[model samples]
Target: MRVGLYPGTFDPVTLGHIDIIERGLALVDRLVIGVAINRDKGPLFDLEERVAMIERECAAITARCGGEIVVHPFENLLIDCAREVGANVIVRGLRAVADFEYEFQMVGMNRALDASIETVFLMADARRQAIASKLVKEIARLGGDVSKFVPPMVKNELLKKFA
Candidate 1:
């Protein structure tokens, strides 16, 4: 089976993320959404909360797309997580030139770490090219509606967190 790993902090998985997940699922037999644990960047939602939100969002997408995509949280090196999940490909979303530059470098490092592993970049949908979790959180924190950007479960969690 062609299993691919899509790793992200996913402070709050957004529609843009769902778009990428849906698109990535098309190219692989199985797609594992790996939620990275980062200590430096404090997240708006706790780790478990973020994982639950992503699970709900991806579940909804899977139901619509009819694909077998697994969502899980990992608190380790991305390559390690990929290895643990028996995945040989890493799927990344590229939004722009800047994103390409950074991802390109990381891909190289990942390749060095595991020569057999490969990285694939999927361009973000034009409509969501500029949407990110940080922006979504900021907008929602300020009482701005982000119903269009995130899933309903995430929106409700944000409302409760900020309330």
Candidate 2:
């Protein structure tokens, strides 16, 4: 079925993420949004909250784009998560050269672990390239408007969290 896994913490799904998912869907029949359960990062949003947020955002995209989007949470190795999701490809969003460097190492490590699964990188839309979850949370915590970075629902959640 050509399933693909797109893994991230997604503490708060940003417009940049939506852009990647929308584009990534074109390459695979089912795109699984793997929400990484990284306790080390101490995300602003809990795993359930992040999953719900991604579900909401992806639902809208699915309605319009006519593709299957599933949100899955995992704490194990990304390749293992891909295996669990029955994904043969891993999708990633690249914002800049810095992102590419990190992703390069990850792709190498993942390939070493499992050569059957492939990693695909989609460049973020130029306008949304600078938008990042960390920056979005920082702006929201500092009382700055994050409407441009995240959806209204996510923006509201961020405000409520910091309030």
Candidate 3:
């Protein structure tokens, strides 16, 4: 079976993320969404919260895609996480040229760390390309409506969090 790892901070799952998740599953038998704990960048949501949010979002997509979407929390090196999960590919989303430049470097580093693993980048859907977790959180925290960018569950959580 072809297993792919889609790792992200996922502070709060957004529509763009869902778009990537749905598309990523098409390239692999099973796509494991790894909610990585980035200690360097302080996140609004905790690890458990992020995992739960992703699980909620992925549950709906799982049935539609006819594939398994497992949410796992990891703190170790991404390559190690990929190896542990038996993933031969790392799925990533590119929203713009800036995202590509950053992801491109990371892909090179990942390849250097594990030559056997490959990185696949999927372009974000045109409408969702402008949505990002940082901007979503910022807008939500500042008492702005973010219903259009995130799922209802995440929107509610953001409201309650900022409320």
Candidate 4:
């Protein structure tokens, strides 16, 4: 089966992420959402919390898309995580040219590590392109509405964190 891995910090799952997951499932039989454990970033949500949020948000998407969605949490290198999940394609979402600049370097390193695995970039839907987790969190923390950026469940969880 064609398996793809979509890796992200997902501190708090956002609508932008949901868009990518829904679209990425079209190309693969299984899509693993690799939740990265980046201690350096000191994410607002813990690993368990992040995983829970992703699972909750992806539930309906998985059902509607007719593909298996796995939420895998990893603290290792992204390429290693991809191999562990048996993913041949690493799917990434591009919001703007800035995103591509960073992703370009990552693709180069990943290719050098394993030439067999490939990376695919999916441009974000224009409506959701400006929605980022960092910005979403900041807005929520400052008592602003994040309903547009995240699902109600996720927004509630985020509000609790800021509360």
TM-score of each: 0.96, 0.98, 0.98, 0.98
Mark the regions of model 4 whose C-alpha exceeds 4 Å error after superposition: none
Residue lDDT tens for model 1, 1-22:
9999999999898888888899
* Cα deviation of 155, candidate 1, in Å: 1.2
lDDT of each: 0.89, 0.95, 0.94, 0.94
Candidate 3 error regions (>4 Å):
none
RMSD of each: 1.0, 0.6, 0.8, 0.7
lDDT of 3 by residue, 1-163 (tens): 9999999999899999999999999999999999999999899999999999999899999877789888989999999999999999999999999998899899889999999999999999999999999999999999999999999999999998999
Q: Quick one: ranking by lDDT, best first?
A: 2, 3, 4, 1
Which 10 residues in a row give candidate 4 its minimum summed lDDT? 57-66
Residue-level error in angstroms, candidate 1, position 27: 0.8
Candidate 3: Cα lDDT at 5: 97
Sort by TM-score, best first.
Answer: 2, 4, 3, 1
Decide which is better by TM-score, 1 or 3.
3
What lDDT is reached at residue 73 by model 4?
Answer: 93
Task: Give the CA lDDT, 0 to 100, for residue 70 in model 4.
Answer: 95
lDDT for position 88 in model 4: 99
